[model samples]
Target chain A: MSTATPVTAGADTAAVRQAIATTARPPRPGPLSTALTFGWRGMLKVKHVPEQLLDVTVTPVMFLLMFTYLFGGAIAGSTSAYLDYTLPGLLVMSVLFTTVYSGVSLNTDLTKGVVDRFRSLPIWRPAPLLGSLLGDSVRYVIAGTVIIVVGVALGYRPDAGVTGALGALALVVVFSFGLSWVFSVLGLLLRSPNAVMNAGFMGIFPLTFLSNVFVDPATLPGPLEAFVNVNPISILATACRSLMDGTPDGEAITTSLVVAAALAAIFLPITTRLYRSR
Target chain B: MTTHAPLAIEVTGLEKSFGDTHAVAGVDLAVPEGSIYGVLGPNGAGKTTVIRMLATLIPPDAGTARVLGHDIRTEGDAVRSLVSLTGQLASVDEELTGRENLILLGRLLGLSRSASRTRADELLEAFGISEAAARLVKHYSGGMRRRLDIAASIVVTPRLMFLDEPTTGLDPRSRGQVWEIARALQAGGTTILLCTQYLEEADQLADGIAVIDRGKVIAEGTPGQLKASVGTGGLKVRLLDPGQRGDAAGILERAVGAVVLDADPAALSVSSADASRAADGVSALARAGLGIAEFSLGQPSLDEVFLALTGHLAEERDATLEEQSS
Candidate 1:
């Protein structure tokens, strides 16, 4: 069978003219608009797979009840004192757990080629990363609020007023947000979601457990005590507890904020670099 | 459509290497504004690499490329603003519905809420997926997902669009649908750079064709120019009598002073430097009292052009399972 010539100079010229006439001018939104767009999309994704929020909602409440009742008497000789000691640790734990999901979601999006699509688009470089971090903060805040409310109901009264409690909560969220940058970087560098999840959990687990999260650092051996005393999460948790319980002023809050900010400074650029390289 | 300046897409000495493998060799291309230029090649010939560089996804090792008067290296943000890319596979989120995917892209492109919704609806209808707009993209068929992927790229109304093997896994019908969409995009005055392995696709859509092999461009021209570049045409002659094939071959060879290949007693294939020589051979055969049952002379097909230029068959490369296994 013979094939006809598909190209005609006149038709081609006309088509090209039409294409030029119809093409729209490109949009140039500022960084704030770009970040908001990314944040909005991340919120939409959270809305779709809401079962993902179960851990943040269910885990904190369960841990609050289990830890305070099961080990309170043995560890502190009384439930109320133990509840006072353990609430800060549980809050930190809840934030850590919720932040790990951010890594998992990032890994999933990368593997699924959604990140690649975003890379191909003409958006701000930090939009997706910043958006996901901000989006997961919703989960963190919800979990933190639920745990705090439940702690108050269970006789764990905050000696600090509403302002101090709010400050403590904000510190926890800011620290968790910083931690997310590290995990998002890990997710990008790792090959699989499970690998990222395992690595993230492994990294955060020791940092949380080795700290004075469950008990005072003084009760530990000298070497472990030194490590726990210096751990950033432990410092933050101590600071959080101090703010919530009106304990004596210490270097924990300032030290934790400085360390958290330093970690974010180091990791945020590394993650952005990795994302661009990919 | 004439302009004093060169074109929207202009490249020279473009090169990229992945570790030790030279993915894209020194290559040059030019596309008149709004023209659909197709890069036709088999896999691993640097089509994707070329597209990546053009799209500003990856920096080329060495080369100069400009799109819409913006240098890919220095003016990457400007180039990125003007263009959009849709890769071979679907890039839409499976967890999101078709409409959600479209709206997300639109929002990222800085469309207002009402404008994003309006554009999303327009694209869904254009791609014939309006009914499936509310359905999760994971439930979409392969064709539907591909269509949605393309629609997502168009949300920004890009001046230039790069489609890398956009129909590789699609069936014939779906391929046709995509072709129609591509043609419509061209009709809208959008410059398109299409990389495809299908020769018919290049022939159907390209204003100019570049044949790349082993990371270098082997040939470039309009389809007719490429065919003419072979500089010779072949004659397929079937003899009236099976035994006459030899006689016809001898007569044709002696008449044109060229070589003739005989496949069977009834068929003879003859090549000549030009159509006039082929006609001369046929006349000589008829004068020698041999009845010519069938005689036709024409320019070569893209397959023959590929073979003549590369000294190997296209089908041979496609049949080898080595690349696929790796």
Candidate 2:
């Protein structure tokens, strides 16, 4: 007998199996409690497999460092001045790119049947999906914080104090939350993880780069400029800029919020319904 | 507990479809309380599909079921509360250490943090993986991972368990270990619904067995009854001399009072309704001076039973999938 044998042998197997019926039923926890349990489990994933944090943490650090020095002087005349402009867009890009993870992790769970046990449990059926979305949002917040702190360190200053910086971060985090549903849809629709990543690359690039995130819309050709001026990514960067520069643009902020809300209203149902039907 | 036990599982006309293919056409089952029921089938025979419906993982398109006397359709929560499932794919988190997996399961079941930790420790020790409790399950061997998975399911010691191919991919030794665990669970008064492609597994473990093919229950009975339905136990005889084959066949058939199913050049076999008729054949052969190389009586092979119940051999899978997919 091994060390584990005695503990198991001491229990009466029949009594234990029947004990579920004899004992008082444990009160069922709310969906939030169940969801957070899974959310906490998701957070631990970045701990055990630290590589999962690369997209959120290391990418922000690397992008802020690279884009600030290389494109800064060329675009804005001085590296320090360019840091002010590029930092906002770079923050948006880093957080936006981190949304790819929601899709990847969700696809991994559904395809590998990782949540199969959760599906059979007595807990709220939607908890895993809700938890997964929340867990990914937490990752986005971490990425956003990294971008802003690194941006500040690189001579980029926000005219808006802590309050404005917090507001800007909140808006971006909510936008990232909505954008995650799109990737979540892709995660469910596509079977291959590689396909999900490729789709993210193809879809996210044109939206983020074609926008005025990196350069002024006034510097672009007429057609490209028109697209950039109306791009949702551009609206997001503009809102964050106004908030950070202490000159808030009400229309930009409203439009960005509206777009994020629309994305969530449409895709959230589709993702949840597809998930439940499975 | 009531003096009169209810059927642990009862269903009627369960149906489900994926696209044009009917994954489970229409299934009905009644499993006795505290008895092991086996659903035996080949790949794509809808064993997993039926189990999923019963386990409440997927809703059936039509029909209904009551598990532990609770309707699966309307009272899925009640049904789920009582039944635990170890799915075809081991559903434990690969990223979590074994201890974390158990703790998470406990927390979901409403155990407090300290209680969950205590329960997790108990389960780990019970499953004999206490030493590896802190190790990530991805690093565990196939046997250790599955043991821990089963251990996790018993966190509250569910009264009814659905084991969907609990030993599908393990080696013989690991398979034996899993079998022991399943037996222990059953001995603890758990009603088990076991689905497997391994006929030997069902035969050894299940008190009653159902042979499913193309999403339908083609045959259902005790293993003995099913095996007997395939035309009785078989009697095989091999002679030392090939020339004596015909003579041996006649003497044995006359001695055993059965028709010879096959007569090869040097060997002969017959259906023995009374498997013990081999004893009669032995004396008759000795009396006839025919040197017997071998003589044995055995029940029909499960494959033969499957072949008898369904037209094709059990291993030959459904060709309809290709037709439906195309």
Candidate 3:
């Protein structure tokens, strides 16, 4: 950070230009380096504009507190019983909702022409999109941490201890990463950030509400209740709940992993293709 | 005066269209190594589309181009390696500081951590943005952001650069600064394909200019050559007395050999092959006993050449394009 002798535009530029030309672009960087370079770029955004973390921090904690206090009595006949059932579901919801930011961020970057600048560079072409997806993992982790701490403070305990908690957290993060690819496509296709956000909410809100996030799937109406049972959100919620409660449901966990893997397989290529063509 | 310099860019019959709009209709150009080639046009004249094609940001749809000897379509990665593009606006990340943007670019260019850090510092100071290097690009002035934008591209000083309207939306002072940057880069043996709407910019910076209009290169030459192409500088004669106007006009026509056209009611103008011819015409009118109030030589402006080539003012042509797009 210290300043060396300031070289103005008119200074000894010949040597600088020569050095740059002869540098030979340093052996084509591997894909990991390219992705990390862009990942570092995305991480800087969260560092500089920490307020970007508001969704992961304030929103999740508020949802945890509101859900536990407001609906605990009606749903479980007591707040403590409700806390155990709802906390895992709420964790899934928080991470799911946080995926919207990925879409919004990509749309904003495109509109600003930053993505165009990245496109012109000689680095691995898909790095920007991949790095952005990886960077959003930070948000998922933050949301998970906030919800866990808040839930623990409100007298909820994870029966499966650190191993179970880590497993469940991994599932949530992986699920969100795959989900981000879907939003990345939305970001690439949408004309504006607001439109991306609105579309994202429209797609996400109903799934989260209709799934077994807040209530037991059995109590719902006929067809709507059937839809909730099969929803990915419900599958994820069941997986996380079982893992955190010391009884990892192999069937539920397999379904969540396969669904996440499927989301990524389906959307990653689609997003990358749309991004390059643009 | 002749030296074997490799062509920095050689492109032919390039074509691109957005739906029905032909953004770049068949075009050809050869930019000399270490020279600044200007692409002059009004807005939406396909200037950007051509630069994009050469810079490997997009495909040309038809035709072939090689940048620094690498093909644009098949060898696009190679094309991108040797060139950098700073688009019309400062296509830089505003979220990061100038320093961070530079470092990021350097890292992407495959520089090591310490090397990129050193290079970033060197470029920050070189572009005169050292003091504001830590400030976010959003906080930089229009001029500062542009300087950083160009600086970022040089993290691995590209052998060729595509600067699309680098001075647009800038104040006169900033425009001059950007021009200075272009000059400095050219001095460093960089080939520049500069696209601009300002005739003066092309005149000042371009070693060769391609004046494009309606998705084609209407004309191409150096500033002096393009001007001279319209015609040799004109000769205008004004008679002091209205009575002698007819006689003066007649005498000047025979003197200059070219037909004299009435520039207005009071003045007669004709093309002169050179300054000496205008000088001779003036004296001939004097010897013919014609009282001339004032006579002057006029050199054709680039606007006049543009008008002749396009059949309308550049502004009018750009307006038409805008109207069509809207």
Candidate 4:
């Protein structure tokens, strides 16, 4: 009804003048605060478009159910045992899959012109990128939680109990955070959101499957085994699996942290540079 | 072109090119502080490019600019701190509610959480968007989104604001509202660099105008000075009967200077440089028994001003731009 009325009906010229002339600008926000603000924006997007959240939520749930029920007997000879085996790997899988959306969302923001607003702001340059990833971390957490919850409901339990489960979730979230910077670069380089999505998955989807997310590397042929042995996802899954078992695989965990740190170190600056130039 | 007022934006030989296209080919401009300066051009005339550079969103290929005494090249952060740009496209987040968009900007600009909410509400009320503040911006009409975009820019009230084609695709009433908002901002001592393709938009809102063509400033002055430099206005007439328009054109040409026929068969116009002669042309039509529907003597439209300056219509790309009533 307000829209149907004349545009002027809503705008009182005197009030507009008063507001513009009277409002005092506050001091500029700090980098962390600005980034947190963008995180808030990401959360707002989730609130408005629940479908984006649903995309992350349902896809991982679907993956968990299909893998445990369909491939359980063939892969591990028991649904419950396979669930125990794959849930940690699937946790890594689900969370990594959600990282691609970081690029997709960044691409969306770029194409929509909102990035112009963010760029023009006097705040820290990497705030939006960092903040949105902070928001995507929520999606990662949700996906991980859902996978574990569904795994528990299906008669699978982590050998290391709640601490193991929580530790695994924390490790996956950190890795996802680092991996998201890679997609953020893609988002900046690509022209469209769809293009970014396709390219991101094109690289990530295969890398995900070729690793030991759904299958153990030992079952594969020698050449494939070597590839899977070096795959970072397999390394990350190994860390998650060990952490979930309360065994604490130091080599795998250290490798995953170093890989996460290395990815962030390599890609974060590139994403920032491309974001400025683009 | 010298004025006592301090300049808010000063540019010298600013240039930027995108691959083969020279989007901004060495444009220079001086915008006096506290006044609304319009960069008038057609679409793809590099108006957006110029604004983007001035806002420090993009670096210029080969020129220098100073906004509020800080150089855009060397002191970009300082320049950015003093200005805001509402892009040609609505820059507010579509997925966020209008209130959220403003609040987000406020918080980013460093307001406390409660202060951000308060300021957002105040802006929502002032811009007449309070009713729709809770609705996501994606659901907003073009007019509402434009309003919110402007509102977002002023949340921190920069010393200068770059409004790039602020009312491009809006209806006339929405356009008027935007004009009102621009004027209010100017009145509040915020110098506005308004970029627009609409000739009349510059004429109506700009205190001084730079007429850019093919990425160059072909003409620059106050609206009156720009119009005066192009000579005087024309005499536009609408004949009651389409049949009498031909006869009326003949009489008007004899009485006035040059006569150009309008697209309407019942309409024709005379390019008269003086008020007395334009009146005489109207009288001549009366004497010829040509019934007149309506007539007016006024300053030259910016189209004529543009044509005089550039030897081409302002809206040269798409002919439909000429049909828009100023």
Strongest candidate by TM-score: 4
Q: In candidate 4 chain B, what residue range of length 10 has the lowest lDDT sum?
A: B317-326
lDDT of 3 by residue, B1-326 (tens): 24378899998999987777787889999889999999988788888888878877778789999899999899988888888889766888999998999998888888888988988888777677888988889999888888888888788878899998898888887788788778878877789999988777888899999999878899988888877676776777777776777777677777775545454667777654467877888899888887788877776444455656776656533444422221
Per-residue alpha-carbon lDDT of model 3 for A1-278, expressed as tens digits? 65896635332345444444555557667789989988898888888888878855787678678878898898889999999998898889888888988999999998887777788888888898888777788878887877887888899899998777778888999889889989989998888999999999899988998999899978888999889999999999999999999999999999998998999999999998888877
TM value for model 4:
0.91
Chain A TM-score by candidate, in order: 0.87, 0.89, 0.91, 0.95
Stretches of candidate 2 exceeding 4 Å from the true structure: A1-24, B1-4, B231-302, B316-326
TM-score of 1: 0.80
Alpha-carbon runs more than 4 Å astray in model 4: A1-8, B234-302, B315-326
Ranking by DockQ: 4, 2, 3, 1
Reference-based lDDT, each prediction: 0.78, 0.80, 0.82, 0.86
Clashing residue pairs found in predicted model 3: B240-B293
Model 1: colliding residue pairs: A19-B188, A19-B189, A20-B189
> Which tens-of-lDDT digit does each residue in B1-326 have in candidate 2?
22256799998999988777787888888899888999998878888888888888788899979999999889999998998998777888888899999999989998888988988887776666888888988898887888777877888778799998899888887787777777778877789999988877887889889888877899888887777687667677788998987788788778875444343567676654465677888788889999988877766554556666775666634655422211
B1-326 in candidate 1: lDDT tens per residue? 24454587999999987766677789898888777898988777778778888888778899899998999999888888888888765778898899988888877877778877887887777677878999999998878888888888878677889888888888887888778778878887788999998877877788888998767899988876766676566676777888777677788777665444444567676544477777788788888888777878754544555667797654423322212211
For residues A43-154, write the lDDT of model 4, one tens digit per residue: 7777777787678768777878998889988899988888888889888888888899999999998888988888898989889988998788888888889888988988
Highest DockQ against the true fold, candidate: 4
Error of 2 at A74 (Å): 2.1
Q: Tell how far residue B149 is off in model 1, in angstroms.
A: 1.7
Model 1: per-residue Cα lDDT at residue B206: 86
lDDT of 4 at A148: 89
Which residue runs of candidate 1 sit more than 4 Å off their true CA positions? A1-23, A56-66, A78-80, A149-155, A161-165, A248-250, B1-5, B227-308, B312-326
